[model samples]
Every structure is written in C-alpha cells, then in structure tokens.
Target: MAGIQDHFKRDANGNVYEVDFKYVRNHVPLNWFFEHMLDAKPKPMSGAIRYGVCPNEPACQAASVHSVKVCVKEDSWKCFSCGEHGDVVAAAAFYWRITHREAGLELMRADVDMLKHYIPPKPETAIERDDSALALVLQKVAEASPYPSKDALAYLGGRGISERVAREACERGILITIPNDAFQAKAFLTEVAGKELMERAGLWKPDKKAPACAFRPLWFRSQSHCAAEFRLMREPRDGEKKAMRYGGKSPWIWEGQTPDDYMLVEGPIDCLSAVEMGSKRTIFALPGCENWEPNWFQMMAEKNVLMALDPDKPGYAAVEKLKPVLEAFEAMVGIFNPPNRIGDLNDQLKAMRGLI
Candidate 1:
C-alpha cells in the first residue's frame, strides 16, 4: 500500500526532505539498503559505517570503490565520488535515476525487517595502543642540534632558501639540518633518548668510522594536532651522497583550523615556499602523486581547495591522477600552476630572486 505519496516531496536544493521521512529512516538501517536495494557487498563492517563505490559513478561501480559512505543510521548517505548526497530515499533515487517517490516505493517493497530488527553490538574493552611509534622519535630528532654555522647558512643560500626562513624554521624545529659537528647531534639525541632510539629513528648510523648523518624526514605533530608534517633539510655530505633519502608518515599539513580552502603542493619544502610567499591557506604536501588518502578529508567536506602542484610533467600527471581522490572529498579545487612554469613553487620563488 506504501507508494510514492507516502514519503514527502523535494526541497529547494532538489534533495528529498529529511523531516518527512523521519519515521522510515529511523526504522530502516543503512545496511538494509546495501543488502536489499543495491545488492552491493560492503567489506565486513565493524563500526557504524558501510563504505563502497558511489552507485552514481560509473568508474566506482567497477574498481577501487571507497567513495561512498553509508552511515549506520539510515537517515543519510553521501557519495564522495560524484558529490551526490541524500537521505536514504534520495540516495536510492540518485542511484536509480528515478523520482524520489519511486525510490520510496521501492524501499517500501524491500524487506525492511531484516535491518529494522538488528541491534548494535556491544563495545569491546579498551586497551593501551600506540600504532605509529614516531612521537618520541620526533622529540629526539627535535632535540638534535641544527647546523647554524656559516657553512649551513651558505648551503641554504646556495639552494635559494633564504637565511631568514631557515633561521625561523630552525628555531621552531620546522627546518633543521644535521649538526655539522656530528658529536653534538649524538649528544643531543642521546640526552633525550638512548643511542638505540636514535638508531631506531635513523638520526645517523656509523659507517666507515664516521657518523654518517641522515638526510631523512623527522616526523612531528604540528600545532594543529589533526595535521602532521615532516621536514628534510639535511645538508648533503660527500661520502653519504647516495644515502637513502628519508621519509616518514605520508599525511602532513601546515598549521590551521580546517580552513575554507587548502593549498596543495608536491613536497614540504614547496609548502614552506608557499607560506614564505604569504599564503595563509592550509598547505598540504602530498607524500607523492601515487597516494593521498587515509587522512582528514571528513573534516574538510565543505572547503575549497587550490593546488599549486609543480609545473613539470610529473606534477601535471600527479594532478590528473589525483582528480578522483579530490572529487571524493567533494572539494572545489582550483588548479593553480606556478606562473613562471618552474618545476615547483619553491623553484619559482628562487628563480624570481635569480638565486637558482
């Protein structure tokens, strides 16, 4: 007997009215829609979520479908893939390209009892946990002294990174190079943590009877705890020319509350360059073009995003690849390529000053 008229009508934004369907949404569970209406399989769900491809996205229905999130409460569903959002009936309408009334009729026919009868599972006991043990290592790395001597400053100058910026970064532990006096680095790290932790964090390892200082990222929590970043400013040494370039956790961002926009760049150095040029937008440096998730997009759903990805071939290619991921966040992205066609933003700044 339940048909189109049973559910309420549309809204100014063309979305199904949430208030009218309050009773149905409360009774039916989200998993019910997936199992009965969509016939889609979600990875074994544990929490209050069931994630899958957006039914509105053709590519998503095929492979790597993590764009749509259906919350346990059947009231709402959002598709990061197509930016399609709606209540359960609206979600079904978007998926089937039908009127909200028709979608409601379909739900009325679905065996809602299967979902409605379910009860939430009990929570498990809490236990101590530390997934990434980089916090203490970060402190130890921060304790390691910086290279403030003339050679260190000159090295930055040669690289076109100004002395002022370097000093500001060094004081705040944003940018720090290997202590030219390797012994100082050893003493500083040892005071904070033992030699073994220093080795664990990879400050340096003895090679050929000398402390071959590491040129890797030191992970640290930024001022905004939600955003994290790593910096690598080690002054290159002769014997360690080919030592592995270091990297830590991938997700990093500059200090900010969730801003109205984001300034995405290729590396942390490029992010600092944009900041130096006076951009207050939250700067997020991609670990690399290939990966960009497992992060805080849920916190940025309504924000605009501008990307100053590098101007080179790889940079362009990365942007192209990232279109899907950004779309999934429903981000309004502005492609802001460097004006001077330099490889990256930092290079553009340096080139303008004739430092390169």
Candidate 2:
C-alpha cells in the first residue's frame, strides 16, 4: 500500500488488484478519453463489470452499472461512469491509435539494433598495370624504318641542319632515301622543284618499304640498371604521304645513373637539332603534336621537361595539356618560344644558327 496510488486497489497484503476508474478518468481529459481510450460505456454487474453500447452510437448510458467497484481512496466517480481501464501500454495504444507493440516500440528511446539489417556494401575499382599499348605502338613504328635517303637529308638540311649534324644523324642510322629507281627519283625531284633538295632525297612511301631510322637514347641508373628509353623517328614522310611507321621505340629514352636533364621536343629532327646545338642533356621527341600521354609525365617525373614544341596552335595546345601533368609530378616544365616563324625546335635551332 505504501507505493499504491489512490487509483489502485490493493489487498491487505498490499497486492494491487484493479485500477480506480474515477481517478483514471480524472487524470485523462474527457474529450481525449471519449475519442481514444474507451471501447464502450460500462455497466455494474454482480461481481464484475459489463460494457454498455459504445459512445459512438447516438443513444448511450450516462453512467456505468458495473459492480466491479473501481474506486480511488479520494474520489467517488463510478467505475460504471467510463467504459475502459487497463495497463499503461494498452492505454497508450488506445490514446495514440496504434497497436500495443507499436506503442512499446515508440517508447523505446535508444534501440539502434534494427539499423544494421538494411544497408548495402561498397564496390572496388580496377587499375591498368601493363604498358602493352605503348609497346605495340612502338613496334608499329619499328616496322616502318629506312625511308628514302635524299628526301630525309633534304628535309634535315632545309631545317638548317649542319653537315656535321647531318653526318651524325646518318651515323645514328637515321633513315635516308634516294629514289630506289631513277624514274621514281626524277618524279620526286620534279614534284619538289625549286627547293634546295638533299643530294640523296629520301622518299617515305606509305608502302611498308619506305626507308626510315630510329635513334634510341638509353639512360641507365647503374651500369646494369636501364631506367628509361627514348625513341626518335627521323625523316618522316610529308603530311600527305603514307609512310611506314618508323622512328619509334627501338631507340627509346634511357634514364642514366647521372641525373641528366632533357628537352622534350615535338619531332625527332628537333631532338637532333638540340644535340647538334650542344645540349648535353638528352632530347626525346614525341611522335607528333598530339601523341603526348600522361605516362610521359610519369616517366620524366624527376627530370626537367622543356617543352620545345612547334610555335603553332597544335603545339600550344599540346603544351597547355602537358603543363599541369608535369607540375603534378614535381617536374620543372619550360616553354620555349622561338624568335622566328619556325614550327619546331629544329626550325628554331636552324634559324638561330644552332643556339638554344
């Protein structure tokens, strides 16, 4: 009885038996109880209680007639006055218009165990590991060597390549071609009339037989360690002619033990010009204006990369794309601006008389 409230009925041993209806109703608002808490009006019976017609009906009893004396110590409103009384959860369910289980769940403030069952897991990403594509491209170039000699050397000399430089290029196996047949050579000379052509004009025919040469510069980390390889294609065909794919990869840039800074030019002739001009550092040529790759930056991450491309729109575009990639690898990127209308490093060198 010590803990029992006025609304609870207790035995002499203080065991609670029932709730006091009047006290419960007093604590509940009439409108709320009418709308949510009850099933029907209650009536007094012999030793129990009976429910009257539901209040939702037009005609209903004013008070309960039940004999189950629902009373509180300080109140006298009859248990027969209201129709329902039950446990706390049941009452909450009735008031909230929800099921008993739902009411209990709602009252649980810290239950987080249900969240683990509905979340999805994440996926992994794949990366490319081999440089086979580059190797294949190099192989294609290798198969296209030994282009016509006169056209090759004339092309070199037109860019103001010196006799010593021309000889050196020849020594490096840079492909040169004189028309294999007199008629073909005569036809080529007639086609290229008025230009101070090479005595041995190298004609690069798209027909796999075109003469070509490859200069592969090797750089080693130790006497035994080959770090990188540079490939150069010499005396390429004119823009219109189909030429064999020569001048790539057999001769590639090799990173040496000593940190030798290098210049990255847009053509093999440009690299040759740099060498002729006494640039002690190695010069690597991209196949064309558009052949640069992100891997080029990765390969030269520790070296100084001077972008000596042609002074043209495509050259500028290539430089713009290459700048950020080189910087990202902590390499120094230098842009070379030529004084003349030359399109490439070799042009610039020849125009400037072999000055860097």
Candidate 3:
C-alpha cells in the first residue's frame, strides 16, 4: 500500500499556516476522470505521482521522466515528474479538471459527520457482551415452521425446474409461507410448527419477529442462510389480493469468504446457478445502482471480476457505471453475455436440461 503523510506549513510567526503539497493536479469529477484518464488504460506512471497537463498548452521539450516529484508545501504543490506545480487549490482544480470554486463547492457537497462532536463516550459500567437479543431472534425464527420443502418442490416442478434441482431444493428446506390472517387457528398452528422445526434445524430463533422462510444449510457455519418476510395479503372488498412484487427487505443471501476471482450477477438465482456450477466467488443483486458501496467493490477488486449482469438495458447500464470504479482499482474485468434466450445462470442451467 502507498503510504500517506500529512504535510503542513508554518507562517513566519511560527503559527501553522495550512497543509502543503509538492504538486497539485487538476481536479476532475470522478466520472469524467475515470472516462478519460482511467478507463482500460494503464498510465505510464501507474504507481507514481502525476500532475496537470493541459491539452491545449504548448509542449515543453525539456520535460523528462525524472522531472516530476510530488511536492506539497503549504498551499503550493508541484510534480517534478511532469514539471507541474501550483497551489493546493490549483492542484485540486487541475486534478479534477474543475475550477477552484467548483472544487470548493464539491467539498461542501460532501457529507462528513464527526462522531466525536455529538456522540458521548460509553459509561465504564456499560454492558459489553455478545448480543443475547440476536440469539433470541434466531430462536424465534427457528421456531417458525420448517420451510415447505414439499411445496417448494411442487412449485419448482410447475415452473419446469429440473427434478434434480427441485429435489435439491426440497432437501435443503427452502420454503415458507406468510400468514394472511394471523387470527386464523390454521395460520397460528402452521407458524408454531414451522418455528419449532426451524429451531430444531438450527435455522432460526424466536426473538426476531421476522421468521426464517428459507433454509440455507451453509448458514449453520457461515451464516449464509437468508430469510424473507412477506406481508400476507387478504382479498380486498373489490378485488383479489396478491403477494407483493418481491419479498420485502429480507436476508436471502450470504457472502462467502473473499475469493480470488468472482462473477457478478444481478439476481440471487444467478448466484445460486454459479454456485451450483462451481463458481464460489460471486456477488448477487447489488443494493441498487447508486448505492453500490465502495467498500464492497474494493473487497472484490482484490481479485479478477467477471461481469455477468443480465443481458438487458438495466444490466448493461449497471456495468457501464461499475466498470470505471473496478478498473480504477486495477481489477481485471470481463463481460459475460449469456445466451439471449437465457436471462441468467439459472435459466442457463434449466436450458442445459432441455427444459427451455
């Protein structure tokens, strides 16, 4: 890792003036910067410092490789490598390819909260122990009915899922139902039995209101098991009720240990397909396009990344936005366009069985 050091300057009276830099590069917006400077190409000084270079400026014949050394002193900075130097604000402006005022505005837009200013220190006697509440929640979930493995098998069969795949899902215990009317005795009985069975399987606890609806065997050791909470729909006075578009916020996936090379997909089904096909390192359905957290990508960037997004406009758009971020961190990126007829890995798996 490159080391970073804070540089500061002092005034003639010995008071600290401000941080200093050896050289300042033009400031460019992250998107534009990635497009023109970081996309697909390795810079000459990939690991070395760089400075501003105006395309319209006349070339300096005396510039040499050794001429650029990044210097940050007070508000001034210079790059010996490119013989480019300027004040701190100037450097930022050049680096971002923006004006000094723009840089200031950008800084203002950044939201940074200092916890020290508002958060009080914990009391010395404050309890510090494993969260027993989590355990109770798990117990409640476990107490819910075991996923309707048989029902899942029936549903998958109706959808043309392979018998083998259906069987695997059944054996894995991957189904649960939401109670449409909690007051109904049948619903309460089902919930009670399901919870007890799940608890016995070590899948859930009673402390949590949301029960585990899916049985993920790996979660016993890795916490990879996921559950979904559904809102039971009842017939409206005028129309039939239907389940919501997708399960509300539920933990339906688990992240395995870091992998050296991974596949990126848009849905959990694709992830399951990849896993079945022996690709262990995979990330499924990001939080959302704009919310793809940098920390998660950084973890994946440590290895080769294959973009296996759905072959659709939304998928393509996601890749377009994500490419630069991955490339900036020097990750190898490959686009995996599955067959047009097959929407994702699971579809591919089904096709292999001649179901499609």
In angstroms, the error of model 2 at 214 is 17
lDDT of 2 by residue, 36-151 (tens): 34543333322333333332222223322322223211121222223334543444555566775554433332123422232311112212212343233223232333233454
Q: After superposing candidate 2 on the true structure, give the runs of residues whose Cα lies further than 4 Å from its correct spot.
A: 1-155, 174-239, 242-258, 338-342, 354-356
lDDT of 3 by residue, 1-356 (tens): 01111223447996544532221122222222222432212122322223333221233222332222243332344443334555544544665678665544443332224211332212123122222333443335344544433443444444345446434433343323323333442345345545555444333335644333332211110122332222222222221111211212222233435557767764434554665555556444442233355545676555688887665544677789889888877788888864454766667666765667
Clashing pairs in 1: 80-328
User: Can you give the lDDT of residue 48 in candidate 1?
Assistant: 40
Q: Give the distance in Å from residue 42's predicted Cα in candidate 1 to where it truly belongs.
A: 43
What TM-score quantifies how close candidate 1 is to the native fold?
A: 0.50
Report residue 18 deviation for candidate 1 (angstroms). Answer: 61
Model 1 lDDT per residue over 1-356, tens place? 35434554568986656334555555555555655567655543323444564546553342233222433333566543333566777766777888776666566555545665655333223222232333455545555645344656675576566777667666655554544455665555456556555454443353323323423333334432222343334633422222222334354466544578787786556766777767778877665544466354554565778878766545677677766667787888789854456667777778766887
In candidate 1, stretches whose alpha carbon ends up further than 4 angstroms from where it belongs are 1-134, 143-152, 167-173, 202-248, 256-258
Candidate 1 overall lDDT versus native: 0.55
On a 0 to 100 scale, what is the lDDT of residue 49 in model 3?
27
Highest lDDT model number = 1
For each candidate in turn, the TM-score is 0.50, 0.39, 0.40
